[model samples]
Target: MKVELVQLAGRDGDTAHNLARALEAIAACAADTDLVVFPETHLMGFPTRDTIAALAEPLDGPTLQAIAQAARAHDIAIAIGMAERDGEHYYNTTVLMTPQGIALRYRKTHLWASDKGIFTAGDRYATALWKGVRVGMLICFDIEFPESARALGQLGAELIIVTNGNMDPYGPTHRTAIMARAMENQAFAVMVNRVGTGDDGLVFAGGSAVVDPFGNLLCEAGREACRQVMVLDFDRLQAARNDYRYLDERRLTLPGERIEHADGRRELMIPQDSF
Candidate 1:
């Protein structure tokens, strides 16, 4: 699977226009690309909750339809983030559109500060399989929590795709975290972040990148332009996993599995009466 991380320059509160341009960018970079990952809130520019809410649209709506069409046209799977409006509530949803017109949606589980009042958090954890590759979806702030990435890794996800709209300039915490999660979980991690400045006097760092399971940076975008595509080798990733064999360490002797809260990290519960 060739995953392409596209660092998009999101338009300021212009969902429709940005979406149309998004298709063009996808078309230009879709060749031999199995998956195309875009930035968070690529459709609706990120900032105020009101602006995000106003730009939200229902599933199978115009924005998604355009995305599906582009996916089908390029024969590639595209993963993107949008402020989704389902009835009266909104979610920071990441939608994965396949070449066959199938869409798997994952709402962001972690809500950043000041965004909790705007978006609803998702309860269920789900990952989608595309072309024999187990892929997991996460948004900007969601990747900050180690639990989310570890959960996906334990669930047999080989690649963690993250869509982000974070713009904390002079800080590289998000970038550092992206590489760390990949290293810790032994999974390929790719993050696509929005570039340029938004309405809130916030300037993005624009360090969109992909890291291997060994935590080595594969490809990264520069500061100025937030648009580039790099191909990732699945064969190399599979070789790495085979050599490490970390997934073989998980073994459950009981029928039912349990999760336990311990200290600050969540841990798998030990089987009862096993002494």
Candidate 2:
């Protein structure tokens, strides 16, 4: 499948501007592009305590609906992040959108720094079928945890997508993590990080990248706005398993309650560690 990574800046709490920018990028994708991905919190940019509640939208809110429409209009799928408000609680979430509506929604399970108090941690790792590909998602900080991708790998994810908002001095961190994650799971990995500055004055890093199942860097961008198209070779992905299968040959498995949805989505309810 042809995937497009959009690395652009977003104004914190400015949903109007962010939505417009996201839509324009969707409309401008190349004809054969199958999926388009944006950086973390692209919808609400990194909401502050004062603006989080006001800017955060529910899963059924207008912002996601608009994205669903764009997916249909362009005959493509989109994976973008937002500040999701769910009644009494809020989440830093990412959703995969198709013409039919939301195919997958994953809340950031690993909150970074201040996010611990800002959003509730998700308890499950999920994946959904996207045009024959078993696709899973990870938010910015989630990539730092090895178990995060392993959960999805156990669920049979062939492609792992990370929507990131990593800032200065930490761009290299994610760059290394993405490659390792792909190689460790023998799955294709892609990350799209934002550029420019946010409300907190942290400059969002823009080193978005794509790694093949063999852990080769196929495409990469620097600290500037960029858009790139990458075609995934499923044959190569399959090749990664020919010699050895990590999931099959592994000595241990994660403890979780695996759920299989009728619509082809899978989730692993991670068991909380007890003291």
Candidate 3:
């Protein structure tokens, strides 16, 4: 599938401008593209805890609706992160919207330091089918944790789309994390981070990139304003799996079932049967 990563400027608390820029990127990359990924909270800049709480909006609010409209018009799928308001509580949510409409929603499971008090943790990882491919979704900080990507990989996801608004401090560390997660899980991973300064003191490093199942760097962006489209060849990914049966050999045993884990950390996480 032709997967595109869009890294753009997200103005703090400016949902309107953010939505407009996101739609514009989707429209620009629509041609010959199957899915487009945006940065975490691309709608509301990654503000401080207090600002994020105030900017949180309902799932069906205008920001999400605007993204859906853009997907429909472009005839492509979109995965984006936003501050989702559910009643009195809110979550760092990532919504996967298809041309037809919203396919699935996955909240960030691993919350950052300040996010602990600001956003609700997700119950589990979720995947949605888009154009015959199993697409997994993860928000910014969620991808930093190995368990998040492994959760999706265990569920038979072929591609994991990560939307991040990663801070600038540990740029290389976070960038390596993407490849590490992808290589360990044997799934194609795509990351889209933001650029420019926001209302807060944080600076975002736009090192948005895509990696193959073997951890090969397909495409990567520097610390600059960038928007690029790269093809995630399904056949090539399958070939890698066929050549090396490592992923299929790894195993994780749950209460009522056992599964494969390319790495040996199978005993750490609880299985579905246990739950």
Best-fitting candidate, scored by TM-score: 2
- In candidate 3, stretches whose alpha carbon ends up further than 4 angstroms from where it belongs are 253-275
lDDT of 3 by residue, 1-275 (tens): 88888888788888888888887888788587988888887887665666776789998998898888888888898898888999888888888898888887888877888578788776666666788787788887777788778777777778888888888796787789999888878889999998888766778888999999888888889877877888778886677687675557877621223333342112123454433
- For candidate 3, give the lDDT: 0.79
Clashing pairs in 2: none
lDDT (tens digit, per residue) of candidate 1 on 1-275: 77777776777678877898788878887578888888887877663765765678887788888899888888999998888889888888888888777546778878888568788887544566778777777888878887778767766677889898777753388888899888867888989888788777788778888898888888878766556566667676666777665556656322224343231222232234421
Q: Which candidate is the best by lDDT?
A: 2
Please list the residue runs of candidate 1 whose C-alpha ends up more than 4 Å from where it truly belongs after superposition: 243-275
Is candidate 2 or 3 superior in lDDT? 2
Q: Write the per-residue lDDT of candidate 2 for residues 168-258, one digit (tens) a residue.
A: 9999999999999999899999999999988788998899999999888999999999898999998987799899998999999999899
lDDT of each: 0.76, 0.93, 0.79
True-structure lDDT of candidate 2:
0.93
Q: After best superposition, candidate 3 residue 134: deviation in angstroms?
A: 0.4
**Which segments of candidate 2 are over 4 A away from where they belong?**
none
Count of backbone clashes, every candidate in sequence: 0, 0, 0
RMSD of each: 6.5, 1.0, 4.9
Evaluated at residue 70, the lDDT of candidate 1 is: 88
Residue 92 shift from truth in candidate 3, angstroms: 0.6
Clashing pairs in 1: none
